[model samples]
Target: MFTRIRMVVLATNAEGSPDLFLTTVDATGTQYEHGRHYDMALPRARDEGYETPMIAFDQYDAAARMLRRAATFIEGGDAATGN
Candidate 1:
């Protein structure tokens, strides 16, 4: 399954698209911005692949959604773990 490493929701554009930045699960702390002219960060799983990439929604729910989804990929050793 695809796992996210570092993902950040920057801002929601005037056109209503949410601005997102993220890096592959194999890598961490390195964030990439996602926009129309750029390719979104690819999701990756150690020793696995083919999982659907993360989807971005409106700004109203982006933060909550990201946090929930991101929690799934976090491991005990992950630096961002709020322990």
Candidate 2:
């Protein structure tokens, strides 16, 4: 069966800081796997002379784990799925 895969990019900026970008690719297929990339620089922000934003990989990994857990719940998994 063909499952739907979706890519989501999240960007954030502090009040006085540059914008940070993150991208996640999620697969809604049988096994449910995901891939993510973080710390991507925003060209516009750079072009306008804004400092390049930074994202800690540890933080991104934690967030990605949380998102995966949420996805498991959204899929209606039980204790058997370790969700």
TM-score of each: 0.21, 0.30
The positional error of residue 53 in candidate 1, measured at the CA in angstroms, is 5.9
C-alpha displacement of 76 in model 2, angstroms?
Answer: 0.7
List all candidate RMSDs to the true structure. Answer: 13.0, 10.0
Model 2, stretches more than 4 Å misplaced? 1-8, 11-60, 78-83
Report the lDDT of model 1 for residue 43: 29
- The pairs that clash in candidate 2 are none
Highest TM-score: which candidate?
A: 2
Model 1 lDDT on a 0 to 1 scale: 0.38
Candidate 2, residues 28-51: lDDT per residue as tens digits?
344343232222223433444444
lDDT of 1 by residue, 1-83 (tens): 33344433344334455544433332222332333211343322211232333353322345655565566547544435444
TM-score of 1: 0.21
